[model samples]
Target: MPGRPHLIPGLSAVPPARRLGSSWSRGVVASAAACLVLAGCSSTITIDDHDLSDADRAACEALVADLPGTLAGKDRVGVEPADALGAAWGGRASYVLTCGVPEPEDYEPTAECSVIEGVGWYVPDDQLTDPAEDATPVALSRTPFVEVLVPAEHRTEGIDRALAELAPVLEEHLGEGLSCL
Candidate 1:
């Protein structure tokens, strides 16, 4: 990194051949273009006809509303956005949600990985029922919720598609009495 220009965290350390104002914009553009990669990734994700009820969707939206506000605040570490840099609500049964980041288990030095996992149950909601406990501890579910890994710079785009794809699976996985909300 000495003789070369420095870049943003997710951008390439080496400068792009084209002119760019700053490393940030270059990285964002590069990553956004990676959305096209989703077509090829389509072969990897299995789709189904999971059926979710209206109540489930309602519960999910309500649950999501809380996360963005709750997560986007100054914590001890620092302020962070509720939604991952590129995250969306998807999956069946409303309980099935995915996030964009490397799954703690799948991280490796060789891979610029990101994880999108579905929580079968979110925290106290899945456990405590005093009607007033922090219901965030969710049980992890969904198949290898780590949807395809791409360059860290393009993770936002890849992750966005992953979340979009996961939404449909929610209904496909819903069961008779399963409560996701």
Candidate 2:
């Protein structure tokens, strides 16, 4: 999880203890936005100059492994690959959008680790507070999935630029009629 959109700096999923402290803040944010599940997944993206320590790296690896079950099936739209699926733990991405189909009625519930950038400070394009009006994102699987961004002095900075660069080339391959997530 290097280049694409990640929860780089400002992006952090709250721990259970922390959640109790920000109950009001979380409610306000939850009601305002919709969730975006990355439809198709490519390799792990690398964007910034992250110097995670060994312990931190281990933590991140564990987090990614825990993500697949969270995105079971929110096939917004797209196709799956011809090669057979990989082992659940063998995959780089937690979930993949292999089943190309119409969007699901309800997205798979956002999990603790699935809240945002599994990386560090990445924010979902769909969740931008006041994003560009003509935000034609590089569709992940018909809908915008994740973007690994370059890090800026601030966690939220550099994201827009990453989106600009990423949205153009990350076209997904639509197969069958369901989702791989």
Best by lDDT: 1
lDDT of 1 by residue, 89-125 (tens): 2211111233222233422334221122322322221
Candidate 2's TM-score: 0.22
Query: What lDDT score is found at residue 1 in candidate 2?
Result: 45
Residue-level lDDT of model 2, residues 128-178, one tens digit each, is: 333221111112232223322111121233323332322222322211121
Weakest ten-residue segment in model 2 by summed lDDT? 24-33
Index of the highest-TM-score prediction: 2
Q: Please estimate how well model 1 matches the true structure, expressed as its whole-model Cα lDDT.
A: 0.27
Per-model CA lDDT versus the true structure: 0.27, 0.25
Runs in model 1 deviating more than 4 A are 1-50, 69-181
User: Each model's TM-score?
Assistant: 0.21, 0.22
Assess candidate 2 and give its lDDT.
Answer: 0.25
